[model samples]
Target: MTEKSFAADLKLYDVEHLLLAETGEPPVSARDAEARDRVWEMAVRSNPALFDGPVVACGGVEWEGPRTLRLFWARVTYRHYALRRVPGAVALPSLFVNVLQPDTDGRVLAVRMSPSTAAPGRWQLPGGSVEPPEVGAVLDEATLAGQAARELVEELGVEAADEDLRLWAVTRGENGSIGLTYRAPARAEATLHAGLESARAADRARGREPELDAIALLADAAELSGLQGAHADYLEQVVRRFTAAG
Candidate 1:
């Protein structure tokens, strides 16, 4: 398969606008539904706490220019991710916000996902699936940035304001998932380490499993190959771009 390209310029339309323009239902047929159910059952058996929540995933993307892309949104249940590994199943591409933090020394921070979550043990930036806007509401750039900021604080214990995040690139994976990548202001490595440790301890105190168990600082793309588990297709490209810019 050919590798996908990343778009540096993005135009985010309101969720309401995208829904109005969306054409077809995601290609989930009865067979796909059966496959999803079987996979979901096994997933829940492994981790019964999984909840099928409502999420807004990217249904499609269109390039309007060399660097500009427009995103379309769709409503999907969290269970739809189970179909990702099922052969020939055309599931809605999950839209997630990935925040890449580069410290003053130029190392980018990546996290190792916890075993209880989907894509456990995978090394990637801190992020989560996009949730749908409230009924009759529209999701705009500020709201999306706010979600990214919240993920940083919750997962890494780093405090970054929404305006501090700059949407740097939008990458589409081979599986069709879209990652809205953002770059935040660089901080001291010691500060990041302390914040992460505090965050992990807080999770344990709350009786909740932290989403990430380990964190690594990568100075270049070559370091990514040393990490474990599957990574998003955009990981290397994002790391390279960030490192090069520094």
Candidate 2:
């Protein structure tokens, strides 16, 4: 498909207008199961600290414009991402909600993943994968905003009201992962730092490593270069867009 055609095919949906359908089964094979085990073993051997957990991944995306996108969801373990490195194997894209917080000074907040997690040391906004809604439950704008708020509280100890989040953009990464980015109301930078520190201390007290070990405020995209390790390809774009808008 031409670049123009591809762009045209992509559409943004308001959280309220988004439609999500459960696929009922994950995109995995017996071979994939075996590969997942082997890859996970190798990964744990390398880090000796990785945790395996259930995570939801996307099965497919159907764009029905006029402001709507339908997402097919699946329950997959975190190991599924490793299968992407296997030759001739395709892993379905995962959808996640990312919240961009700009401090009162206009610097954007980014977090560094802990060493025990997948994508350790990478810098990205605070968020997690979209899980399947409860049986008989409805997934809508309120549900998504609630999830975003939960992440903020769990990961950074920042309590943001659901109404304070505005769905700003949907970004697709080079590997097809989708990020539903939201803009959060700005707060004092000191307040953000204190909340994160408290969250990290609480995690340590519970004998668990926090999901994020470091946080930085990017005054502009140029500061992003100073962060160590890999980053989601779309992160730079998000930073630039937010910084420019300010």
Candidate 3:
């Protein structure tokens, strides 16, 4: 693979046309499978909260026309990503959805992953790995938007209609993972703060730690530099684009 294809920086694309097709999981060698299992066990030991839940993985993506992409995917568990640590393993890329929630002032919301969650301390938009749809169900743009909306409510306590969440952009970054970004309606800054507090409180009541530990409203990508911990690879690019448009 070319260096550019695996570059750490994210390549952003406008959401013009997207096609999703189901495909079989990438073949794994016996050695790689054993290594992957060992890595996942070690990870679980380190973070007991880790769950090997079902998720969608991006098999590959190809361009059919300008601003058009055809993405092949397969069902896999979170443990499948552990294969990335196995030598010579060609791991499939992760597929996830995130929402760009801006306040009325055009400041976008960014949240930090909690210690209990994977990627602890990393600041990113409110989102999670895309869960595979039930058997006989389909995965598509509308489904992705709905997942994004659900993430917004879970992380930020904001309820947005799935239809109102517009497909904004697509990003490829860390581990060649694919992300679908959605734009949500702007809300008052105070309202956002209140909602986050409520969400965190609810999680606590359920005896579970909140997925996000902190939140920030950044006006531009440069502000990301001021954050204490590492920033998600696609965050700066997404923030810059959102801020520049206003």
Candidate 4:
């Protein structure tokens, strides 16, 4: 089988229904497991904030029909991603959700990762790896929307009702990772800035660093070039789709 090229353009899908099915965790060989552990330990030494907490990974994806997709997921921890450094070891793709938070002027919000993060200084949407659902619970579109809304509140101090989030697009990017992008109700730019300041203060009060260090609102993909940092692979694609929709 040909290894998928990470350089390939991201594929976008207009998925209305995401049918999730569990395949459990991917099998890791003894050699790969040892290597993964070593890599993870080194990573932790470099960034103590890197947690091994449970997260979801995408095993595979299949199109069920028009506007519908069947996604196979697995429960894994952040450490599983370290397999990427173990040559010839196949790591499950990541599953995550992000919000395309836009201001009243139609500019989408992008945030810079703080020094404490795994991808420090990278610019991306406000989101994180999908946490595993509670025991015996199912992962679905509504659940994903709830996660997206919670991310905005946690990262930006912006409150959004779960029902208010709309699944805007699904994207497949490098390493076959899947990203679920949701559209949030537009808010005033001033309101967003105030929320960010409040959230930063709250984090500092807890003796922790804010997850996001800075933010920018862009009306189109062209504006992304002005941000001085590596960008999330799907950022440009998602931003283009957002701007073109207007």
Residue 67 CA displacement from its true place in model 2, Å: 3.6
RMSD of model 1 against the true structure: 4.9
lDDT of 2 by residue, 1-246 (tens): 112112533433233345777775545678877887798889889977766766667676666664566767777776777787777777777778889888999888999998877778999999988655767887666787788888888899899999899887777775677777878889898899899998999899999889898999998888888998887777888888888978
Model 1 TM-score on a 0 to 1 scale: 0.85
Predicted structure 3: lDDT: 0.89
**Clash pairs detected, candidate 2:** none
The candidate with the higher lDDT, 1 or 4, is: 4
lDDT of the candidates, in the order given: 0.78, 0.78, 0.89, 0.89
Q: Tens digits of per-residue lDDT for model 1 on 1-246?
A: 111223444222112111112323477789989999999989889887688998877767665554455567877788988888689887777889889898889989988889888777888899988878887687777788888998999999999999998777776676567778777889898988898998999999999989888888999999998987777667788788778877
Off by over 4 Å in 3: 1-10
Q: Which digits, one per residue and each the tens of the lDDT, describe model 3 over residues 70-115?
A: 8788999999999989888988899999999999999999999998
TM per candidate: 0.85, 0.86, 0.95, 0.95
lDDT of 4 by residue, 1-246 (tens): 212222356478787887888888878999999999999999999888888999999988777776777888999999999999999998999999999899999999999999888889999999988988998999988899999999999899999999999988888887889999888999999999999999899999999999989999999899999999999988998889889989
Give residue 4's error in model 1 in angstroms: 13
- Runs in model 4 lying further than 4 Å from the true structure: 1-10
Clash total of candidate 1: 0
Q: How close is candidate 3 to the true structure, as a TM-score?
A: 0.95
In candidate 3 the C-alpha lDDT for residue 33 amounts to 91
